[model samples]
Target chain A: MEFSKPIKISRRHVLKMGVMGSAALSLGIFRSQLVKSKTGSAAGSVAAQKTEQIGFMYDQQKCVACRVCQAACKATNNWEEGTEWRRVLTSDKSKAYLSISCNHCEKPACVEVCPVGAYTKREKDGIVIHDAEKCIGCKYCMYACPYHAPQFSDDTGRISKCHFCYERQDNGEDPACVANCPTNALTYGKLAELREAQGGVDQLEGLPNPELTKPSWVIIPKKE
Target chain B: MHWHWMIIIYLFLGGLGAGAYLTSFAAEKGWLGRNSSLRRTGYFIAAPIVAIGTVLLVFDLGQGLTKPWLLIGLLANLSSVMTWGVYILAAFIIVGLLKGYFTLTNKSAPNILTLSGAVLALATGTYTGLLLAVIKAVPFWATWIMPVLFVASALSTGLSLTALLAPLVEKKSFCEGREGRAHILLIVVELIIVAAFVGIMISGVNGPVAKESVALVISGVYALVFWGYFIGLGLLFPLVVYIYRYQRSKVPVIQYVSESPSATSDLAANEQKGHHSYLTIVSDISVIIGGFALRALVILAAIPVWDGITIL
Candidate 1:
């Protein structure tokens, strides 16, 4: 009868119990915040938003190597001479006229490599913007961009690239390059709408041989 | 004068400084327990140098204000060497400070923290080479051994600087003992590594890019600096001095905690305190200067010359 009962708690037992209790409390708080924040943000955004298409489509065959778009971009951005944000590249394969510019990628390499967090992606419109003041001119982003979108200005030692004319877009105006294109090769619209209206890459004619860099450019091949 | 060039230089300098500091720190705390003062000085100087180097990089970016956050927010990108480099540099700065404090206080830093910091420093130091090497666009920089070469260069430069400064920081007598021996050993390793690195670069003559890079380094615009500074003065001169001293039947007399004060005083009194020979000082300075030149040249030479060449 005297040896009937014993109660014992070790340090390890106490520590384990404490850890589990704290973890449970943290998990509960985290779960509640996650649910609450998700719905509130979603509801606020859904009320006034209009779906608009804003993306680029290039017709390689139609490009005449005039580089009007490149000139228009420089004028719009006020870029220094000899520093073209958009460039025209010619290779041996087919007398190809390709305008190399920022693709505004879904998974942008520049954003990933920027050491100074100067680049941001817009959630609503998928526009990638760079703040020059935040740039460290490390050129890491320059190397990361597959399209060679980011251009480093030797004068300022910062990366400069196409901003997609956010000022014009906000005012409901098209980007200068799109406005100035004579051949209508560079078209900007909502990505979803553009995807729906255009034929797939296969439907387009006179396209160059596909390379591995899966450029986001929606190309419409011209009939030969 | 491309901004990319500046960034690359910054990376090289930061990595070299961080690597040297970490290696010296390890040598100080490890079983060698020699040249603690020299190691301490190396770590202290490296932290500031790295900080400045990073600042130069950011300033060159033209958005220095946002640069810090960029480094902090996107600190993890395992696929990119540049991302890893940022984290490594950050860790090195923090750990280098703590380790310096511990050394001064005669306290032991947490084992985990020290080891992790060292590993990070090593990775950061070596990754600079990997960054260049991985860029297939620059055929000269695309070798696997580039990283090792970078690490070796960093070590040599950092140690040489440490040896040069130790006498100035502490009593000349303090540097004369076991610490000097460790410095000698490190110099030996550095020379061997430098030789191997140079050999590899030369052997790549079959590849035009590699051949061009080597030519740029050896007989081109940078030939004099490369040969006169890095090879003859930085590496060879130091090696010869180390060998001569090692052979002269003079082992450095280190101070031990167990030695009696009277005995230590007597030894100190009897010992003829020697200045780091003028040649050693010259060699050290030459190596540091040469190291910087080598890094700058590597960055410039690694870029493909044909990148922007247009055919008529």
Candidate 2:
């Protein structure tokens, strides 16, 4: 069950927004897009450009609950000693491990709640990026995100979270966690393709329903 | 998880300030009929109180500030709940100041201006609730009735403050009379709304999460606070006091004559005879303290039950 609501653009609204953007900029507003589309478009298009959903696929059965992804993320990102962007959550019985990072959601609450417009879903790709410079460290994003994606960075006193490894992808590499997954349980590809390849879903037994933000990822449940 | 005592404090103060403005506005609109003291007290207290709340929010956000010159994150985004809050709060403060200044100077405030300020106060109260209600994460806060509950609570707390403070500035009659009953009515409504919020959460699709959250208040670690501090002292005691004192005349029948010196002087003379019962003072104090406890209780108990984040 997808928890995130998808954005719909009738082509007219986008054009109207484009016109408004240019008009404002010409008037010396020098402003970035302060408001993002709530009904986030299914395609990862930011502006006029069309983009595909580069999604993550996680398999529960072929896995051991390893902290390698967390380690790799820290090492690769050079995050502070005690700071972590991704975390491992387990059930009370420890029957399974659910690794959580930023969902890079379609209608991200972090972006919506950030007072300074610090979070942006890159138009070229749909990567939900957090610009460190613009962050006011209110932790409102932490409160708003249902999945608790944003982690408070004590070092900087600002909230930090995963950005789908935008830098790595730009450098023609996979995310630190997915690349370092020794079990080969983590997969990354086009979202539509991954859905057909595996019976991927957005909801699970104990996790927050992903239908709220329509997380741009899929998960394979354990075999019955 | 971080303990957001600051947020809780802000919530209480915001409700108090906004609720005062609303109740006062209601009096000014003639909804309460001739309680000028209510209007004056509300106008006087709202600006500074809300200003303090806004400042608290700023410092809370200032946690990550590296440079003092950043001017405290004034940047606004329409999509942000905080951003909307900043605007609404600013509007409230501005209009409140104008209305207050004009009224004090004996300049008549147009109905439009007064109406606008009241509307803004209403927004301020509702937005405070919306901030939490929109957080789909914490199941305890994710309820439809949150906005309504907060508004009612805000009114109750706000009116309670006005009653307590107005006695000191003006005559005790306003606080001791029908306005006191109105304050009680607001509290009663707030209690009912809170029950409805919990009831809906437990009975609806959110039953599982809501039940666990409710347990924290009913039988969990915070049970003592929820029952003792909030429900018992804040709500029940005040209610009993209110019922006992005002059982005879449900509606205060004194005609408000601001220009009638004879009536005003008579009230001042009557004031020396202890016009407001001690229990009324105790009830107002209970409501105020109870209101603060109520915020703290729910917020403290509101730790989301972490079931699991299923990636598979």
Candidate 3:
């Protein structure tokens, strides 16, 4: 199918113009840097030291489908009654329950789709959080999330979902959902350590829902 | 199934419809007299409609309202349509207000201002359809033809509104010559686009999403809105009216000269033509209302409920 000329022009022209404009602006900065170097002064400061890394690890086999985590999420966040930031989905036929929340991916779709920069991923920990104040409640994030994790609150009109308990983690405590899990199914630790401990899912086990968004969780096969 | 999406869709369609009509109206009226009484009325009416529509969109976003600044400040994602839409609509409101102000002051408006506003209005009017079309996941909305159909709907609705309001604001009588004919032609085009869009949607239902969307639009809850309003009243009825008028206008005149062979006949040709023009204006109003209804229905029906569906 033949595409319109205007589409091609707009796409190419906008990009070219943007690059040219940036190059000119950066040239000015580069000349100023050279002047600063002549004066024997550093143009920039050193990067900050790395902080503690925070993330989640879910043991699917240990999850009894009791959903205490879901309850704990609501209680901790004081979210509206019907809103569930953390949802527990169980396949009765397979006797497996999966607790799904925001994966806080290296690249988050919610952050990408938000019209207003209401959604953000922390560079330090890769934790995605919503700033309700900036939220226009467009709900584009809901469609973008492969996990279907984000939930819109009717009372607030803004998108509300799990923040992985950033506050609790800041205080050196596990997330409410992970802390309250009875069977130790949920774990919170450094992302690298969790990856090393569980070794990622290699094959389908106990009705694994492959369609689930690349969750940060590790699934251990349930023992018969 | 959230009502907020419905509100967002309504605001988008209404603002675009109002903005496009105002732009076309201003363009038709010379730039010098852009703030004339007719233009003033159009802008005055349109500004509030768009402003109120935007407010409705904000209200739909919900309460916590923490990061309202994200829209303007940090969260402007150029890649996403929603982000662009927010910025475009925001620009529309700003430029529209400035245009209104300049008109009130009886000053010559800037060409760039009017042109940019028109372009933004056009983008705002059409992007909603494109937003849905880009989503490969939703079969019903994934079509190259959707954006063109949206543009047609926008023009149809915009023209309909101007036609409906013209008699009240402009001194021109409803039943007259050129303007009436243009209105009729626009409605005809709008009807054709809607037909093509629906045709494509129904014919391509190989996937589950496609089948579900088609079912929803044709036989499900959307049927009343699509068929009852968009198809039945919006397109079909307007086509019948335009055709009937065209036929009457084209009919060969059968004049019978009785006693005096070459006597001057005062048949009042202009007066009869005026009557048909008035009918055309009424038809334009019907088509515009129907077009608006179609846009509203399409938006509400297109969004899927992402409750249990796992994203791969």
Give the winner by DockQ. Answer: 2
Q: Proportion of native contacts in model 2? A: 0.42
Write down the TM-score of every candidate: 0.67, 0.83, 0.71
- What TM-score does chain A reach in every model? 0.69, 0.77, 0.70
Q: Rank the models by TM-score, top first.
A: 2, 3, 1
For candidate 3, give the DockQ. 0.20
TM-score of 1: 0.67
Please tell me which predicted candidate would have the highest lDDT against the true structure: 2
Q: Candidate 2 on A1-224: residue-level lDDT in tens?
A: 23222112323443665576455433322344323433245233445676567777888775687878888988888775455687766654646666667778888878887877778887666788887666767777776777777777767777677888988897999999999999977778877787786577876776667766778778787766
lDDT of 1 by residue, B64-125 (tens): 55445443333433445665666667667766666665555556657775676677667767
Q: Which ten residues in a row have the lowest lDDT in candidate 2 chain A?
A: A1-10
Candidate ordering by DockQ (highest first): 2, 3, 1
TM-score of 3: 0.71
Please give the DockQ score of every candidate, comma-separated.
0.13, 0.25, 0.20
lDDT by residue (tens digit), candidate 1, A8-94: 222344366558645644553464356446645764676745424256777777788788998899888998534677777664555
